[model samples]
Target: MTTEDERMARFARTPAGQRGYDAAEVDAFCERIAAAFQGSTMLTAAQIREHEFAAAAFGHHGYDRDQVDDYLDRACVDLEYARRGDSPHPGPERLSPRDVQRLRFSAPPPGRDGYAAAEVDTFLDVVAATLAHAGPTGLSSQDARAIDFCPAEPGGPSYYADEVDAFLDVVVRTLTEQEQKHTAS
Candidate 1:
């Protein structure tokens, strides 16, 4: 059987490295340390350092600030659970990765639609108010001429709607294609 040192070396070579230990072992260690720290309102820098050492030993190693922040956040969450006498194990009760992905891809919320509507109304209202205040000075002669001659609908030859729409369509298409390419990768 491979020794612990050999296992650690092999783990370091893998993509997951030291942060991919069996969940049960990781959870148990977290629970024990959390219980020890229970009822403490705040941790000193030394206490944080000691917890960081224990975290590294428990396979939560990371070099980047964001990764370290996430590890620390999870540590706090586990501590809170332990303090409440909750099960320390991350079991089937936890949301699956597939569920998380589904939520991310879900349609925008109703509040988002309301926000968009409000923004568009505000923009149009501002434009209208500016035109009203300027009377005719705000508009160039060409703009006034176009307003007088152009068809009320947006698709006449005098109107630039088709060109504007085409440009917007191309932008949307390019962005969607880029997103698809990244998701495929």
Candidate 2:
């Protein structure tokens, strides 16, 4: 087996009494992931992101849930680059939907102006969806550049403008790079 194959199979199982992802289901999924890596199957990043596994408990202890999720998150990024005919190794600059999902920004200090919390969060959800299923029909870098959230009303919850803009820049660059690669091919 290749290094990637070993990696896929290396997820630790949950302890004896704890609930975790079903071992059988996770193992089967890993086999599919390995097949995809070997170019024997077609599996998109979105599919990886959306996959669900049954839960296991007691003597049937399953794989650690966090480990499986984290590994799958990385696999989705690598698979996305592979699908684009780019190097199979996703560069550090690439942003997976998981990355976007985990992003958190500090709320602005009292009396400071910032983007509306709900609006920014909503936009981020769209951005994550775009990354998960990017295509001609999905949101593009241009769309990201054009997004303008409403400013938070005074005393209302808000995200720091600088942080939001920085993250948006990263999103734009990631989308633009993906588009470039697709066009080049």
Candidate 3:
């Protein structure tokens, strides 16, 4: 078995060998990643990130989807960092205020309680600065969840709460990753 094949084997198999991701599909994808890592293929990091996989469900056993996704993410990140000669230790991807503002969401209808759009915008502004190392707030998921939004004025729209919450999760992940890297150094 190849090294990639061996790595794939490390993941937990389906119970009693039931339906899972197709073995051939998994093998081909792994081969591509292996080739990229070994300088045999020109698979760009963006391609790695955007690549889609076919669902493998049949009488034969296959790999778990979650495990495959996790590994693929790690592999893509590895390739990106490798290409940039990055150590993923000291530097964090600086998210700009504009980037935060550009996060698209469907506004809630009038007369309904939504994530106060203004409050979320202000918080995102702060998050942008924090990510850029220009702010003091160590925002966490809990802190984000604690934030309350007021009802919108009559016929006024507010940001969707679930979308805002999902964005906050991304923010927290970015902040914690930066902090951990800094601390490790």
Candidate 4:
């Protein structure tokens, strides 16, 4: 028998022997298994069957499926250890007021169209309150800079300058018409 064949036969006899696989082949198999099981809560019966097929395909010639699976389970635990980055040692730190403000505004508004103007005002008020207690946290930087650079309101300082002005014009015209009708009657 060839060396690979002999190894396979030996693996079939041992409890944990994967028989025909080299270390690199075993590592590759472990990576594939990890990818397949990503985000899985628990393997289903169907998934177990699929894994059995995979084991058969990857196993050394004459190697039993159960032995391949047993090796695979240990390989998966090793793969998980590889996936989790090196554990950090405990370190010292100081909690600043800026950290508190960061915690406060970290959650953005939810939903498709985002917050309405009223909701934005409420959020700004909360942020302002947080800054007041904690000191200036650069909360209104964007609005303050924009106001300093471009101070004009939406209608360019005229009541009848734009769509909002046009809408107001229409409202006034409708009220005048109603008043004229009342006078005529």
**What is the C-alpha local distance difference test score of each model?**
0.32, 0.74, 0.58, 0.32
Best by lDDT: 2
Q: Which window of 10 residues has the lowest lDDT sum in candidate 2?
A: 1-10
lDDT of 1 at 85: 59
lDDT of 4 at 128: 40
Q: Which digits, one per residue and each the tens of the lDDT, describe model 4 over residues 92-156?
A: 02222232233211112122121233333343354345344433333332433232112233323
The digit string of per-residue lDDT tens for model 2 on 26-122 reads: 8888888888888888886656766898898557878899888766765665565566665454343577777677666667656668899999988
Which candidate number would show the highest TM-score if scored against the true structure?
A: 2
Candidate 2 vs. true structure, TM-score: 0.50
Write candidate 3's Cα lDDT for 1-185 as tens digits: 23353245445556555666676777777778777766677876456545776655656556776777656655644555455554432212454455564455557534445666677778877676665553335565456556666655655557755455445545555666666666677
Question: Candidates' TM-scores?
Answer: 0.22, 0.50, 0.46, 0.21
Off by over 4 Å in 4: 1-10, 13-50, 54-61, 86-185
Name the regions of candidate 3 deviating beyond 4 angstroms.
1-9, 16-18, 88-137, 141-185
Clashes of each: 0, 0, 0, 0
Arrange candidates by TM-score, descending: 2, 3, 1, 4
